[model samples]
Target chain A: GAGVSQTPSNKVTEKGKYVELRCDPISGHTALYWYRQSLGQGPEFLIYFQGTGAADDSGLPNDRFFAVRPEGSVSTLKIQRTERGDSAVYLCASSLMPNSPLHFGNGTRLTVT
Target chain B: GESVGLHLPTLSVQEGDNSIINCAYSNSASDYFIWYKQESGKGPQFIIDIRSNMDKRQGQRVTVLLNKTVKHLSLQIAATQPGDSAVYFCAEKGLDGATNKLIFGTGTLLAVQP
Candidate 1:
């Protein structure tokens, strides 16, 4: 695809269950970012990957939320023991450089029941 | 912690009219500011950006203004269209290189009415 892509446009899970959201950034892009947006609000930063390594993960809410860009091209966000408060639209973005404009995917909407 | 806020939660404007959305940030050290438009069920799309060295920047039909003294930002759309209706967010990029984070404001819902 020419743009960033995200899997499972919508995910419905039960509390205490686990879920993984995937993001495929644009080819050759070195910077990838993850953010979470609640209803009627802006996205809050989650984490960012410079390549295969995570340069920043401080925005992650807790230990239950983790993300990895193992191959430096595809990234996965893992959530353990999902809670109702975890429901939101998980967005993925990629940029040529950290300061460059970001290209975003449609996002994966997760609903915890 | 840094916080950004919008002056108005919503704004309704007639099609073909100009629309302006305002935002305020509390951080004085922020050097990069960006405006993003998010449609329903879609991720935020970058509209425009301005650095601390520049006060104004224009892109296509949109213009972004930055005022460092007051820590204010504004996004102006030349001609409002129904397709342009969406939530606009103002974000300030943290100067810290290690984090690579941008703090976003709540947002302003722009309604373009025909």
Candidate 2:
């Protein structure tokens, strides 16, 4: 793909339901990032991956939020027992390397009812 | 926890005027900064970036100024257009021990009226 791509541009789920968001980064890019953006706010870092392993997961809000990059390209963010506060736009970005300019996707808007 | 913050929550400018967005970061160890523009129903797009060593950098119709003394960063857009109306964000990447995370500020909404 020309840029990072995220699946299911919009998702509506009930509270306490499990939801999974997928991201496919640009080919050959080694770094991927996940962020959460609330209404009227900027994107907040959730996690970062350097290749197939997560380099930083400190930004994950709690145990309910988790992300994985299995092959260093496609990634998935899973939220368990979603709360109303979890309703936000989930963004995915990729860069050639850490500290490089990130290419972002349109993002998946997840609404927890 | 450390964070980046914007001085203003909203900015309104007339078309063809220049717009300036300001941000203040508390982490001195941060070495890289980037400005992003986000439109409604879309993700943030990269605008410009500046490193800590440099005080200023310019791009197409956009310029970023960094003042390490005050830990302030500003993005100046020349000839603002109505199409430029969007939310602007400032992100900082720290050089501190093994943390390559980019921390983003609250964001400033820019509204350019015709």
Candidate 3:
């Protein structure tokens, strides 16, 4: 079975720019999540979506970060006015349901210079 | 605040030897715990998961032991192999109205010596 897939394995942008990371969840997964991992640290929760609606967005650091899953499967994480502090690997994961074990994709590493 | 932490930053073991990784969590209300293995430049992969009600759970060559009384978690790998070398992290599911969120620990790197 196909696992969760993320596009643009690596992205480099200038500060104050905007970038979008894409995630394609598993065929039937009903839940999708986004996390950020800094150097030498564990992944930090960012946002989560159930079906087409975001179930939880509290983990999002600020208003600059926003995510959407319009068709209920493909998701996009958008960052506005990126900062060097935002440099990190952005991970995407999906599960069959809310409580199911999540399957992760080889995240998209974003670097803001 | 929900925080899960590891006891060791790194663990080195000989191939074929048993390996043990320990973790401690702060939220006693957490009922679900999971172990994940992450290789360099790759995302985390699920190893095993256990509920608070169970003290121990076993998989192919891995076992997870949980001590709720002390808020401790341990992962044991029997006959460790080089392929098992990677960073191991224990994550606890938060109960603060964000059930889908998982609080992860600062991972423990496992290096298998041949």
- For model 1, the superposed segments whose C-alpha errors exceed 4 Å read B1-8
**Better model by lDDT, 2 or 3?**
3
Q: Report DockQ per prediction, comma-separated.
A: 0.56, 0.56, 0.58
Docking class of 3: medium
Model 2 Cα lDDT, one tens digit per residue, A10-87: 999999999999999999999999999887777899999999999999999999999999888999999999999999
Q: Go through the candidates in order and give each one's C-alpha lDDT.
A: 0.91, 0.92, 0.94
Better of 1 and 2 by lDDT: 2
Candidate 2 Cα errors over 4 Å, as ranges: B1-8
Give the clashing residue pairs of candidate 1, or none. Answer: none
Model 3 Cα shift for residue B40 (angstroms): 0.7
How would you class the docking of model 1?
Answer: medium
lDDT of 1 by residue, B1-102 (tens): 423433438999999999999999878988889899998888898899898999999999999999899999999999889999999999998656745788
| Candidate 3 residue pairs in clash (backbone atoms < 3 Å) | none
Candidate 3 lDDT over A1-113, as tens digits, reads 78889999999999999999999999999999999998778999999999999998999999999999999999999999999999999999999989888899999999999
Candidate 2, clashing residue pairs? none
The top-ranked prediction according to TM-score is 3
The DockQ value obtained for model 1 is: 0.56
State the DockQ, from 0 to 1, for candidate 3: 0.58
True contacts kept of each: 0.65, 0.65, 0.67
